[model samples]
Target: MPSTTPAPSDDQSPASRALADAVREIEHHVATAGWDAPVRVFALVRTQAALDAEPSLAAQLSPETLAAAQAQSWHLTSIEQEGLPQAPDLETLLAGLSWPATVDGVAVTAERVVLPPAAEAQMPSDPDEALPWLLAHPDRQDVRLAVGVLREGSTWCAVRTRANDSDDQVGQGPDVVPGLVSALRATLA
Candidate 1:
């Protein structure tokens, strides 16, 4: 269930290269682990300049390619229905943050800031009140966002659940929880 954000090849233009590299990288990762299970991954690739010039393209497929190139470009979108979670859409209000840690066995970083169920569900009413405990971990990032560590039965799943929103924007909530957990095993490796 391992997935990737592939990168375009070097021989292509910087824009195309970025695209290919993202793809290749993801493909390589999945292949290395010999994953046959379905996995969801979202990747955005654009040259620094291209993104600077046309920011909307960040979530768009290139429009200039021939049929074959376009087909390759659409691979990610095509496979999106396979049920992998898409990364949260870019938000101008939230600064992207990456913090290293292992929740359960998967070692990865998350941007959503949250607290453990005890502190979040039982403790003080003030949001800032949880700061000391939430920020206590040296590995935790200092951001004005909620972080979460999902514990389903025995394993823990850490992620940044969206702020001010109960609806999960990424990953499976309950229906695909098992698959998501399986996918994490590969990510941890």
Candidate 2:
């Protein structure tokens, strides 16, 4: 499906703008390449120091929150739906988010790929090792895959299709990516 860019008149927060831009870019790519599956999403996080380095976020913080200095801020930056192949690199994209220092949590929604039990059994137990193999697999072509990862190690993935009012497919837990999330977590670990 072709995804629409969030209108500029929508919420104008920095996060919303960033997400909108990402969606726009991804949708463009999908339009040309074909959106055989659903959209995928990933989360980005920033450290308190990283947020402090940005001037725009200064007004978003309070003296109390600044004094209490947390290790990380929880704001999500969306990656283009191309998964790992989107430009600027995931680490670089996350670093550029510039979220407010006061923020400390992020939530992500994404399309997911669920492997068949037999396919899952064939995957490597190690995430770092599995990632490359998974990316190169022919079977992956058959399913849509999206992943969301938090700095705190929490991860979720969506899979298949469910009826929804919107053009997008929404995925929930229990039916999402179990083995893939595990592998992704292992890579993070």
Candidate 3:
């Protein structure tokens, strides 16, 4: 007997809608990558104030959620905040983070990687010096940031996915190098 259970409607909730949409987009983008493991998408709220006042109706989140909240909204703010590490580098910056977390009773895991200080220092100062290497790395749906260290100091940048494979690239609209450069600049600042 074919029981006709209606599919879930899109009007679940504002936060759920956003979360579901984000998840779908992430899944679609991640599909081409050959990953047997499950990769969950989350939003990281940076400030304590943001964490406290998080939109209750926004969506389920994880420790990784802190980064998204930390991202600059506009192009100018993004560029102005160059050298400042964004959510993608949160895990890398903090080396001891575990896989799963409990947030408001919801459990989630963030698949992320961090570049060590030494590796960061080796990054090419000119985007051209480093862009090709950046393009050659893996295609991951998780946050990707460049962490660098100079003789005087260190820095970080968010590596966009598109610089390499045109088809599977993510976050290509804006110039990812600037934010990455900003993080590097700030680290050395």
Candidate 4:
């Protein structure tokens, strides 16, 4: 079954919902470049806070964006982190990172090949050798995971399968990938 983002639950605070929105925006933006993409990262900042830091930015920001920021106390702007070093270990990359106070939160979008439980029996036990097996596994589902984390510990996750293939099919919630979520949270610590 395809995954889709549901309406925010009643318990979601405005800040949490805004983080979700930023995560969704990052997810959709990454999806536009297609699948099998590299690990893309972003820094989320409150829109008004950004403008406060640099009034000159007002000219660059659109009226609609400014309006949305004013409409809700939760609006955020996602700024992409370009030129990330190529690393085989995502956790390693994240471990070496830390965000400044100016950054309200951090987000990352990455693709993974998910294999069925039955297919796991044929996999190599060696972590180093698993990449080739995972790549060759025909029963695998290519899924992209977009995760965002706030310094206050709030988190949002979005997942989209290559099979489903659409923005509407994106599934979202908190901590979809627990391990990755933890790593992202550490960046804001």
Taking the tens digit of each residue's C-alpha lDDT, what string does model 2 give over 127-165? Answer: 899878777766553434444434354444333332231
Best by lDDT: 4
Compute the lDDT for candidate 3: 0.32
Candidate 4 stretches with Cα past 4 Å from truth are: 127-129
User: Could you arrange the candidates by lDDT from highest to lowest?
Assistant: 4, 2, 3, 1
Maximum-TM-score candidate: 4
- Tell me how far the alpha carbon of residue 127 in candidate 1 is from the true structure, in angstroms, after superposition: 3.4
> Candidate 3 — number of clashing residue pairs?
20
What TM-score, over all chains together, does every model reach? 0.24, 0.36, 0.22, 0.92
Residues 1-189, model 4: lDDT tens digits: 355457467688888888988898899989999987888889999999898889898898899999998888778999999888767678888988888999999999988888989898889999888888888888989999999998877899999999988878888888678999999988888
lDDT of each: 0.31, 0.41, 0.32, 0.87
lDDT pick, better of 2 and 4: 4
The per-prediction tally of clashing pairs is: 21, 3, 20, 1
User: Over the stretch 1-189, how does candidate 1's per-residue lDDT look in tens digits?
Assistant: 111222223554433333333333333343334322333333232233334456675566455422334434322211112333344432311123221232221212223344555555654567687666555743442211111111222222222232322222222121223433444334423
Better of 1 and 4 by TM-score: 4
TM-score of 3: 0.22
